[model samples]
Target: MSVTRTNPALTLGKYVALLAYLLFALFPLYWLVKIAITPDRLIFTEGTDLWPSTTTLDNFRTVIFQTDFMAFFGNSLYVSLGTAAVTTILAAGAGYAFSRFDFGGKKIIVAVMLITQMFPLLMIIAPIYKIVASLGMLNSLTSLIVVYTAFNIPFATFLMQSFFDAIPKDLEEAAMMDGCTRFQALRKVILPLTLPGLGATLGFVFTAAWSELLFALMLISDNESMTFPVGLLTFVSRFSVDWGQMMAAGSLALIPSCLFFIFIQRYLVQGLTSGAVKG
Candidate 1:
């Protein structure tokens, strides 16, 4: 018996659709780079030009030397990394429990977590501010890290639980039969397989914390403690906004996130679900 292959026209159409989506998603990034490179004098004059008539590194130089750009970048990095680490650890534990155990109020706990995500963050900002103030954590990087971790944990836990659920319970059972403890089985047999999910969770949480501005703005009072997103607002003057510097800082802020994803994109591509299902 002969089997028919997919129609070439259908394959071609799918490729065209994918290419269109790629262009749509990438156009904004292209605009950012275009604007960042265009000279201040040519910014408005070159309206809609694909290429800049003139390019200069002066904006980047001024952002680096004349402003607190580096400090803000460092602060953002600290908070993002801290939040990712803490949230990942907590989520991993919670996800494992959710995946492996059945206990009283499990449904209620999951429902509550889902409910927490349903509320608009703005609604809780007042209560959060009061709590942070009572704890004397305002204007501190620790406060930012804590808040970001708290907000990110529920989603990250769900992410981790999905990954854990995709893993085979048979592997752990076999490992235990081979004289390994549950923790050892998880470490050796499961963790290596879950690298893609971990990388994705880390990337998501890091980006979320890195670009967060509202909470950072409300919780921080000191200029020195401002994150890069909040610090971008500093470029705005009462009369004239520093468009050049703000865009420069904004462009610079993209570097770390880009670099982070680049570093993890390899591990993130592996199909952790390959052995998850029986044929």
Candidate 2:
């Protein structure tokens, strides 16, 4: 057998490209952390510097102790988790139906879901506001959960359907042949295989719900119910914006999403690698 040799130049080029992409993507995040640590007084004077001469933790101290950032974070967490759970459950059921059964008007139903995604979100904000007000759900976390689930279900359904399609029907059928019920097969065999897909869908929906600003701003006027995105706006005023404190708060806000990804990274990696090999 002959040994294959890889080109060193091509390998070097790939590493260089990856490093460049990483730097580009991470640069903004680095800047956010940098500004968060920089003193407010130096924020303007040394804003463009690669490094600040002095740094302080006062910004973080103020954001955590002096403000209601924690409350806003908790509210955001509740809404995001609720939305992700509800959407994932509904989407999984819907996707399973679409993948396994032939039903009349299925195409029409899918078309409608796609159409909902097509309309500019801004166009429906007014109608959504009116409906929330009429239902007396304004400033309610449950209302945010409901609205977010409704908006996210279509896309999440598609993602689940793709994963289900990747799975072979023969596996489920064989489980049934071996005395397993459909639901039993789903719970034991199918779901285990789809863990990666589930993780991906959950992560996507959680991040979206967490970061949504416009709807949060429109629907929640009560400070107690305000999510992190809306609460961040309080750092701004007509006359001035608190740059250091705002950056500090923003960096702190990133913790949940960061931890979420860290928890799910294994599943995400497995999913991508499996997809690549299977494809």
Candidate 3:
């Protein structure tokens, strides 16, 4: 029997739909870049223009030289990286146990984790604040890191559990048969296979922490301790808004996240579990 190929029209339509969705998603980013490069005088005049009539890098220069953007960027980086690292490690460990073990209270533990995700963050904010205050971590970057890590862990743990489930137990068992201990098998065989999951978890947690504003606003009082999301609020004074500077800072803040995804996107594409199981 001859295998039939997909119809050309259907394939073309699928590509068309994907292209349309991509353009729809990316149009805002295009507009942002357009606004960032446009001269202040032309900003109002060139409203909705695909290309700016005049462009200048002065907005970026002013944001960098005349603002506390670097400090905010550094704070965001520290918090995001710290949250990502801590969350990923905890999630990975929890996920491995969830996937590999059969123990009493496992179902109850998972149900409780799910329940934790059900509550609105507003309900817990007061208690979280009180706890942080009691620990003298209020208004500190460490507070932000702790809060972000805690908030992100449940979801990251679920993500990691899915990844761990996708991996085969036989691989670990085989390693054990070859004289490797459990830890050695996990470190040498399973850990390499879980890199994609780890990368995705790190990226997810980092972006979540980087964009979080509510906890940062509530916990951090010092200007020097502000993350980029809260720092962006500085442009919104009581009377006037600094649109140019805000957009410039927003654009700058996108760089690290972009670079991070670019570095991890390769591993994310690889299906490390392809050979781990028998079909």
Candidate 4:
């Protein structure tokens, strides 16, 4: 009876602690939502209030209808999708080769890939800029897509290799034994089963491409070509910043990323288990 009574108190304490931690961690997002909705006049006045006395949609309205957010959004979407698709395809092929083949210099190739990942991205910024300029692809969205695809491929290949390694080789051999070519087995059998891995890789590469800013800033300068992350910088200048509108745009920016995850949530969790047992 005493233990049972004490258990409730412990559980209550844990809940209180968890609630505190959650509120603390989520405070910035809460503040973002708060400021985005707070009347511009009241933003400074109610700055410390937990809840604003009144809220408005003016900021969101301004960001969506009054700004170049839509164009920036479209550009970002195009680059991110292109990068994700290409990176996933390349990573899938490389991963398959790594998982299924024993080749000369396989370890050396993998070691080089790993080494590329270990270097700071900042170290190669100048060289990349030079290469992009030499190709005359500066200020182009295609350039961003190509750069992002290359940068993401190594890590993504490792991730794909893990997924491929998990599937049983016997499955492929069985298909071959029944008169199917390896390519046919890969397409008709392995491809269908690899949906989760593909989705996970697609989601990862997409998210990385969506959020990338430094490279976008370096490569794209044309107003028409600027991605959303770079456009966010346009919110600032030699003058004061528009905090409310910036936050509003930021809040709106989250929607696509949220949607991407919504589409991948099933595969995201399953990818964990998919990599557990390598056959």
Best candidate according to TM-score: 4
- What tens digits encode model 2's per-residue C-alpha lDDT throughout 1-279? 854887899889999999999999999999999999999899889988988999899999998998898899899999999999999999988888878889999999988987877789888899999999999999999999998999998878877887898899999999999999999998888989988788888987898899899998999999899999988886555214688888898899889899787866766655445433432
Cα lDDT tens digits, model 1, 47-109, are 478988778888788889988889988999999999998998888888888888899999988
Assess every candidate by TM-score: 0.84, 0.86, 0.85, 0.89
User: Taking the tens digit of each residue's C-alpha lDDT, what string does model 4 give over 166-267?
Assistant: 899999999999999998998889878888888889998999899999988998888899899999887655214576788888887788888888987876
Model 2 Cα RMSD, 1 decimal: 3.8
For model 2 the local lDDT of residue 74 reads: 92
Q: Tell me the tens digit of each residue's lDDT in model 3 across 33-56.
A: 778888888877785689987788
- If both were scored by TM-score, which would come out higher, candidate 1 or candidate 4? 4
Ranking by TM-score: 4, 2, 3, 1
Cα lDDT for residue 18, candidate 2: 100
Q: Residue 146 CA error for candidate 3 (Å)?
A: 1.3
* Local distance difference test, candidate 1: 0.82
**What's the candidate order when arranged by decreasing lDDT?**
2, 4, 3, 1
Model 3, which residues run further than 4 Å from truth?
1-20, 262-279
Judging by lDDT, tell me the better candidate of 1 and 3: 3
**Local distance difference test, each candidate:** 0.82, 0.87, 0.82, 0.86
Which model scores highest in lDDT?
2
Number of clashes found in candidate 4: 0
